[model samples]
Target: MLNILRSHRISRFAVIGGASTLVYAVCALALSRGGTGAAMLPATAASVVAYAIAGLFSYAGHKYFTFMSAGAHAFELPRFALLNAMGLATAIALPVVLTERLGMPAAIPIVLTCIVVPLVNYIVLRRWVFRDV
Candidate 1:
């Protein structure tokens, strides 16, 4: 089973990425919608919070499930953190730019960010973060 999964690395990453993206979207929607009637928080702020919360799950899932990285935390964690920081920035900034700046629908940027981040993350994780594995 492990060997089969190891052989299907991209499939495993898609599964984990789907799960983490779901987590992030749910949290972002809840936080963005659950506030005062007229004075709701901006989607960017909500996205940041959501990404931070979901990021914990993402790191674990990618390390153990997607990449199966047994690398040292002292090394990998910082790299993962950097990558996640880049992801978070994209997740937050896209929504803000698309929705607030461009007058697009909120969902547009949310969906775009979700799609774009996973692709970039997969490449980075495969080529850099989990390369030693």
Candidate 2:
């Protein structure tokens, strides 16, 4: 447990993730103020923007710190973009469906979906997208 927590790569990834979440939350809040009905598009757009910005940092951090890929390869950018797109879709769709379609609180579905998706994202990214080993 301690060894896993102490991993330099994981630590850096956590930092990047935390920052991205902060960005998302701020954007969501600002958008949500315009009434719930009006908030959806702006919030979604903001989330996508935040994901892109955060993903850029995440890819660099994972390459250098977590998985320790020395430099970019021909396939790296496209593969990374693809993985990020999948993660972004999951992140966006789950929250929207749970909150809007199901009439649940935004926070509940957002939190629950976030918890679920990260596990999947990590597995996909580690094994398929950024396999350093």
Candidate 3:
């Protein structure tokens, strides 16, 4: 646990994830206050926006601090974007489905989805995007 926190890659990714969640929370709150319809749009938009910001940082952090990939930035960004799109979709869809369809508390699904997608994102990014192959 201590070793994982000490890792530069983990630390950087944690910070990025934290910041993105902050963005999502703020957007969700504002939208929910405005109207029910506004909530989903803003939530999804916030996830995409936050993911874009975090994705850029994750790429640089992973390249320099994690895997230290030798690939060109041009190649890496597109792959990163693609992986991020998948993660973003999961992040947005799960919360919406849980809150709207299942009638669960909105916060429950949001928190769970946020927690779950980062693990998936890390695995996919590690195996597919930044792999030595």
Using TM-score, give the best candidate's number. Answer: 1
Q: State the weakest 10-residue window (summed lDDT) of model 2.
A: 27-36
| Model 1 clashing-pair count | 0
Write candidate 2's Cα lDDT for 1-133 as tens digits: 7687547656666665666555555555455532255564544455566566667776776666666665465666678788778878865885567656776655554455446645665667667777753
Would you list the clashing residue pairs of candidate 1? none
Rank order (by lDDT, best first): 1, 3, 2
Q: State in Å the error of residue 45, model 2.
A: 3.3
- In angstroms, the error of model 1 at 121 is 0.5
Residue pairs with colliding backbones in model 3 are: none
TM-score order, best first, reads 1, 2, 3
TM-score pick, better of 2 and 3: 2
TM-scores for the candidates? 0.86, 0.69, 0.64
lDDT of 1 by residue, 97-126 (tens): 886798775567778878999999998988
The candidate, 1 or 2, that scores higher on TM-score is 1
lDDT by residue for model 3 (14-69), tens: 66656655555555545443234436454545445555655666667677666677
- Model 3 bad stretches (over 4 Å): 1-6, 33-70
Q: How far is candidate 2 from the true structure (C-alpha RMSD, Å)?
A: 3.6
